[model samples]
Target: MENPSYWAVVPASVRYDKKLRANAKLLYAEITALCNKQGYCSASNEYFAGLYDLSKKTIGELISQLARCGYVRLDIVRDERQVVVERRIWCAIESPFLPADPPPKNQGTSPENSGDPPPKNREYIKENKTSINNTPLPPTGAGIFAAYAGEHAGLLEALQGFEEMRKAKRKPMTDRARGMLLRRLQDLAPNDPAMQVRILDQSTFKCWLTVFPLDTDKPAAPNPQNDRRQVTNGWID
Candidate 1:
């Protein structure tokens, strides 16, 4: 079963910042959604690129912009292998939107404070804590493509070939274009990665970048001419 989605709270002041670009505003919301209780979001640039239809470079730029504007503090965390594993995001703005720190267990109400009973929401607190702590992070964009490549060799070859052709023609694929391709692949084959490769292969063969629903009724042949052509010469006349 799918987990319930959490809300990414954006402060009105930050949301309506006139100085920041529209992309920066949107990126802030995305980052906020992924942040944990400590305002540390561990998502990578590739993840943001895949989610926002932007290039990894663009995501990096936007994050830097947000940092400069005093919205977030970016910390690069490296693993024991000395490889950067996470981009720790700290929300610098002290807004109500930020998650509150959990209170200490031993801090009970004192007699001076009227000895009021603790709020009767222990279950709710436990549930919220579990949800926040156990929430799964999104995979990086390179991870997504790597997974597809591992399972579908033919499709991977087709994509590589297409990229090579584009490069040979001096038509480099833009970040936006790559994002669009990934989006389409996800849309067309959300459940089946292999099917996405097939679609990509078919599209590439036709010298087309756009993907459409496959005609399952038709034979899965490479040549478009294999399909019977109607006598259009007399019909059009």
Candidate 2:
């Protein structure tokens, strides 16, 4: 009989994270292997969805959740046009056996010890201070939206209005949904201030997650003359 292949090890913390879904854990392991080999994982959402027979949105949600939970960090690379060109995924969990940076030569050695063979630096191994859950918070929706608003004052009121609408409707925005909407907005307008203004003007507060391009031709202005005519004709107060 053929020998069994070497098994991949899953961290106990990852396997036991109650907040982590089974699919996410499996994806994490796959991504961990890729990161270990190449220092990062560059798999697309479509690739993961097809591999696991899940929808692309589900994959995105899982990845976002994993990032929020500190199992991974996603570095989204955008082109000058503000389109996402690549996603570089990194394993955030620290490895127990990770080697520390080597100490500078002659720093710790005395003159008497210089003549003798220097003792091996075993501090890292002895200390082993790796903490798996010490991961920082991933980039969040509020953070990204705040950044956009900082660059574009025109978006501030519109975005705040959108937030109020969501609050009134009791619809909470998830990090994944927020990221998707931000990317879609960027893809639609890039750095065009006028186009972004038009898009926001035409946008309805409902369904904040979906972004649609602005229609051709400018939005029609409200006719104050028509309202006056209606009042004069006793149509309404």
Candidate 3:
């Protein structure tokens, strides 16, 4: 069996506007592959420059062009390292290009009537369960991104969600609350290096993230406060 593809949805569909368009195959593939990996994900021009083998000036121009077209996002911040962390996510897909018709989630039938034992291979059912309780698969980074395209792309989308929960949902979440949501998201979904760029460019969590991490008193996970911090303070600036 083939390993998860590190590339696909190639020849980035660069949209200058709702109507205008263009394509770049190899460059697109390289960027996609890098995004798929995980390291190159950042909004910082410097980071992107190093990853794509381009100069800072060139990286800046590319970012400007992509942003104008909505194919990339740039979040900026100055942390202790003083390095700007860029969380790029895929606008590479025309930045809302695809119709919002996401594939529907699976709705398993109830087992109360069927009474048959649950399949051993299914995730929701325990190995010794008598029947499926209609439990759904837990929300996972891979699952979230899978709603869009490939595993890598789903990973990218998951980054966006991570940004939302990690940064966007904070109280008074102004454009100054970038947190560790994206980094945690990256940690959870390390399927692609190209994913780093996409996440950094759009919803970067690891590039130059400033995470406060949650305290012990809070819920087990999904710290809204930290997320708010990241989102308000340039989580996706």
Estimate the overall C-alpha local distance difference test score of candidate 2: 0.59
Q: Model 1 residue 47 lDDT?
A: 69
The reply for model 3, stretches above 4 Å from the true place, is 1-5, 15-28, 36-40, 43-53, 77-83, 86-89, 92-237
* lDDT, candidate 3, 1-237, per-residue tens: 122233333423442243332323333333434332111223334444565566756655555565576554444433332222234434235211121122233436454223222333222212212111122332244332332222233444544555455445453222223223433434633434464434444433443343332233247767688888998888642
Over 3-89, each residue of candidate 1 has an lDDT whose tens digit, in order, gives 325556678878889988889888887676665544457666766787767886788788889889988887664433222344567
**Number of the top candidate by TM-score?**
2
lDDT of 3 at 116: 25
Model 3: number of backbone collisions: 52
Residue lDDT tens for model 2, 134-180? 23234456655644543345675666566556666687677666666
Between candidates 1 and 2, the TM-score winner: 2
Any idea what lDDT model 3 has? 0.37
Residue ranges of candidate 2 with Cα displaced over 4 Å = 1-9, 36-38, 96-237
Global lDDT of each model? 0.59, 0.59, 0.37
